[model samples]
Target: MAKLLMDLTPLSYSPALRRIWLGGIFSTVGYSITGVAISLEIYALTSSAAAVGAVGLVALVPLVLGGLYGGVIADTYDRRKVALAATLSMWVLTALMAAHSWLNIHSVWVLYALIAAESLFQPINQAARGAIIPRLVKPRLLPAANTLMMSVGTLGMSLGPILGGVLVATLGYQLTYSINVLAMTVGIWALYRLPAMKPEGTAEQPRRGGLSSIAEGLRFVRGNQVVGMSFLVDLLGMFFAQARPIIPALAALSFGGGEIGAGFLLAAGPIGALTGIAFSGFLKDLSRQGRFLTLSYAGWGLGFTAFGLIAWVFDGQGQGASVRESLLRLSLAGLALAFMGWADALGGVYRSTIIQTAAPDHIRGRMQGLFIITVVGGPQLGTAGVGFAAEAMGAPLTAVMGGALVIITIALATVRVPALWRYVPEPVPDTRQIPSV
Candidate 1:
C-alpha cells in the first residue's frame, strides 16, 4: 500500500532538501504562471501565432549557450553561489516583466529581450542545482529525491495555469506578473539555507571551464549511449509534439474558451503529470526503467495524436461556444494532454534518474546542463517551430503531424540502440557530505 504512493523518505531524510522542496512549490508555481501569462500576453498583443512562436526562437540561443556554459560554471565553481545569483537575477527580470505591463510600456521586442535574458540565467541555476542534489541526499535515495523534485515541478505546472488563467482573465496582465516576484522569495530563501555545493575533486584540480571543457563534456555524452539516448529521445518528444505555441489558437479557434480555455489546455499536461508522480511509489526500486521509458515515448506520441484529432474534429470558433459545449471540448483535449503527461511522468523520472545516476559525479553538472536543455530548451525551440507551424497548417494538423513524427523517430532509434532498455544505474553509497558556507 505504501509503495503505491510517492515515497516520503527523501523528504523525511534530508533537512536541506526538505526546505528546498517545500519552497520550490511556490517558486515553481511562480515560474509556471509567468510562462503561460507571457504566451497569452503575446497572443493578445499580436494575434499572430508566429509572434507567439517567436518566443521560443528568441530563447533558443540563450538556452543552448546557458546549457553549455552553465554546465561549466556549475562544475568549476561553488554551485550554491551560482544558483543564488541566477535566482535573484531571475526574480529581478520577472519584476521587470511586471513593470512592462504595469507601466503601460508594452512591446513584444522588449518582452523577447527579457525572456532571452531570463533563459540564460535559468539554465545556470538549473545546472548548479541538478549537480548539487547528488551531494545533498544519499546516493541510494536519488530516484526518490528526483521524484520529489518532479512532484513540486509538476504541481506548479498543474496549478500555475489554472491560477494564471483565472487571474489573467479577471485582473489583466499587470497584476498577473507581480505574483511571481513575491512567490520567488521562498525559493531564494531556500537557496540561502543550502550548503556550499562544490563539485567533487575541485580542491585538487580546481580550474575554470572553457570551450575545451565543454568539448570534453560533449565527448563524454557522445560515448555514453544511455545518457546520450536519453537526451535525444527527450528532444524528439518535445521538438516534434510540444503543444504550447498553438494552445491559444486552439482555445480561440478549436477548443473555444479564450483565456480560460487556453489556461485549461496549458494546465492539463501538468495535472496529468502531477497525478502520476504523486502515486509513483511503485517505481521506487524498479530496474526496468529503460523498458518503461520506451513505453512512455509510445504513450506520449499517442496522447498528442489523440489531442490533435479531437481538436480537428471539434473545431469551434470562440464566439458561439455554449458554456457547456466549450467545457466539453476543452475537457476532451485536456484529457488527452493529461494522458500524455501521465506517460511523460514515467519517462521524465526514469530518464532523469538514469542521467543523474549513470554519469560520473565529476561531469554530472555538464550532463545535467544538457538534460535541462532537452527538458526545457527543447520545448522552447519546439514552441517556436510549431507556433509558425500552427499558423501555417493550423493547430490541429500541425499537432497530428508532429505526434506522428515522434512515434516514428523513437521506433527507429530504439532499433538502432538496442541497449537503451538494457541499461541500469551504477550505485554509489551514501555520503552525507553537504558542503557548508
Candidate 2:
C-alpha cells in the first residue's frame, strides 16, 4: 500500500510542479465559484435554460482562437511569460466580473462579454501549463504525474462548485466573484516563481509565426495516427456526453431541490473522478492505453444512460412527485454521474500520458495547445449542442440519446482506427532531434 501510494513521487520530485499544482487548485476553485455564480445569475436573469446554455456558445469561438494562436506564441516565446500574461489577464477579468456584479450591472450581455474575454485567455494559460509538465518530471514518471494533476484537478472540481453554490446562496454573486479574484492570485504567484520556459532548441522565429506555426502543428498531428485518434475519441466523447449545462434546470424542474441540488449534481462526477484517481496507482504500469481509453468511454456512456433513465422514470416535470421520491431520484442521478466521472477521469489520465510522452518537446507547445482546445472547446460545443437538443426534446431524453451516440461513435472509431488500439509509447528519442517539417 505504501509502495502504491509512493507512485505519486512527482509531487515530491519537483518544487516547480508542486507550486504549479497548488496554484492550479486555488485558481480552479475560484473559477468554479465564478462558474456556478454566472450560470445561476444568467438563469435567474433570463429564466431560460437556453440562455444558460448560450454561455458556452458565447465563449467557444474566442477559446478556439486563443488556443491555436496561443500555441504559436508559446512556441515562439518564453512559455512562462506567455502563461503568466494570460493568467494575469484572467485575474483582471475576474476582478472586473466582481465589480460588474457588485455595482449591480444587470445587462446579461455584459456578463456574456466578460465570460468571452476570460475564455480568450484561458486556452493560452492552459496550453503553456500543459506543455510545461513534461519538462518538469522525468519520462518514466509521466503517467503518475498526469494522474496526480488529474486528482488535484478533480478534487478542486468536486469541492469548488459545492462551495460555490453555498457561497453564492448565502453571500451572493459579488462576494463569490471577489473570492474568485483572491483565489486567482495564488495561480499568478505560482507562475511568477517558475523558471523561464523558452522553447527547446531552435525556437520558432517571430517571422515564421502565426498561420505557419499552426500549420506545422497540424501537420504533425495529421502524421501521428495515435495522437490524432486520441484527440478524435476525446472530442466525440465530450461532444455527446457533456450534460452539465442542464443541471440547474434538472434540479429545479425535475428534482425539486433547486440550486443546492444542482451543485451536488455538478459535484458528483468530480467526486467519482477523485475516488478513481485515489486508486490509480495501477495506471502507471498499464501498457494497453487504447483499450483502457475505449473502456472508459463505454463506462461513461453507460453511466450517463443510467442517469437519464433515472430522471425519466422518477421525475415528472417536478409535478406530483413527493419530496421523498424526488430526493431518491436525485441521489440515483448523482450516483450515475459519479460513475461517468470516474470513467472520464481514467480516460483523461491515459490520453494526457500518451500525448505528453509521444510528442517531441520541440513542438510540444503547439500540440498541447491543440490539446487544450479539444479539452476546453469540445465541452462548450457539447453544451451548446446538448442545450439545443434539450430545448427540443428535454434534458432527460437528450442525455440518453447523447450518451448512446458517444458509445456508438467510440466503438466505430476503435474499429476503424486500429493504430490507436495498438499504440504504445515509444522511447523518447534525442531531445535535439526535431521531426522534419
Candidate 3:
C-alpha cells in the first residue's frame, strides 16, 4: 500500500532537487494568485471579457520571443545565474504590482505592461530550471522528478486561485500581490544555493546568441523525431481537447447551476490531475513513454467527449433552473472533467520526462525553451479555437467535435511517426551541438 504512494526517491536522493522543488511550490502558488488577481482587476476596470483576455494577447508575443531567446541564453550562460536573474526580475515585478494596487493606480495599461514583463522573464526561468533537473537527478529517476514537479505545479494551480479569491475578498488585491512578492523569496533562495550550471561540451560563441541560436534549436527539433512528436502530440491534445473556455457557459446554460457550477467545473480538472499524480508510481518503470503519451491523449479525448455528451443531453435545461434541479447533471459533468484532467496530467508527466531524458545535454536548455512556449502557448491557442467554435456551434457540440478531432489527430500522428511511438529514453549523443552558421 505504501508503494502505491508517489515515489519520493528523487526528493530523498537529491537535496538540491528537493530545495528547488519546494521553492517551486511557493513560486507557482504565488504566480497562480497573481494570475487571478490580474484578470479580476482588469475586468473590474474595463468590464470587458475581451480586455481581460487581452492580457494573454498582449503578453503572447514577448512570451514566445523570450522563450526562444531565453533558451539561447540558458545554453550560452550559467543556467543557475540565468534562472536567478529571471526569478528576481519576476519578484520585482510582483512587488511593483502590489505597489500599483496599494497606490490605487487604475491604469490597465500599466498592469498589462507588468504582465508582459513577467511573461518575458518566465520562459528564461522555466527553461533554466527545467534544464537543471537532469543535472540534479540520475537519468533513471527523471520520471519521478518530473512527476514531483508536476504534482507541485498542479497543486499550485489548484489552490492558487481559491486562495487568491479569499485573499482579495478579505485582504484586497494589494495584500494578494504582496503575498506573492514574499512567496517568491523562497524560489530565489533555492536558485542561490545551487552550484553554477554551465552548459556541458563546447560552448557556442557569444555572437551566436541571436537569430542563429533560435534557428539552431528549431533545426534540432526538426531533426529529432521523438522530441518533435512529443510537442506535436501535446499541441494537438491542448488545441482540440481544451474545454475551459466554455465551462462558465456550460454551467449556466446546460447544468443550470450558474456560478457555483462554474466554480466546480473549474476546480475539477486540477483536483483530478492531483489524483492522477498521486498514483503515478508505475510510470517510473515504463520504458515506452511514447506509447503512453499517445494513450493518455486518447484518454483525454474520451473524457472530453463524455463531458460534452452530458452537456448535449442537458442542453437548454440549465437556464433558470435551480441548483437542486441541476445537481445531478452538474455532478456528472464535473466527474467527466476530472477524468479529462487526470488524463492530461498523465500525458504531461510522460511528455516532459521524454524530452528531458532524450534530448542531449548541450541543447536541452534550448529544447526546454521551445518546450516552455508549447506548454504555455498551446493552451492559449486552444482556448481561442474552442471559444470561436463554441460561439458558432454551442459549447457542447464544440467540445464533442474538438475532442473527437483530438483523438483522430493523435491516432494519426502515432501511426505516421513510428520513430516517435517507439522512442525509449537512453543516452543521446551530443553530436548535433549548435554550430555557428
Which candidate's TM-score is highest? 1
Residue-wise C-alpha lDDT for candidate 2, range 133-185, written one tens digit per residue: 88888777777878888876798889887987788778888998999899999
Query: Could you give the candidate ranking by lDDT, starting with the highest?
Result: 1, 2, 3
Candidates in order have lDDT scores of 0.86, 0.83, 0.80
Give per-residue CA lDDT, model 1, range 1-437, as digits (tens). Answer: 78889988988889999998988999999988899899998898999988999999999999989988999888888899999999999999999999999998789899999999999999999998889887777877888899999998999989999899989999988888999999999999999999888788877764754887788889988887877888888888888888888888888888887788888889999999999998898897777788788879778988998999998998765555644669888888999999999999867888877887766666778888888888988889888889888888888998899899999998899889956777754445566442210
Compared with the true structure, model 1 gives a TM-score of 0.96
Instruction: Report the lDDT of model 1 for residue 220.
Output: 84
Q: What pairs collide in candidate 2? A: none
Better of 1 and 3 by TM-score: 1
Candidate 1 residues lying further than 4 Å off, grouped into runs, are 206-209, 426-437
Error of 1 at 52 (Å): 1.2
In order of listing, the candidates' clash counts read: 0, 0, 0
Window of ten residues with lowest summed lDDT in model 1: 428-437
Which candidate number would show the highest lDDT if scored against the true structure? 1
CA RMSD for every model?
2.7, 2.4, 3.9
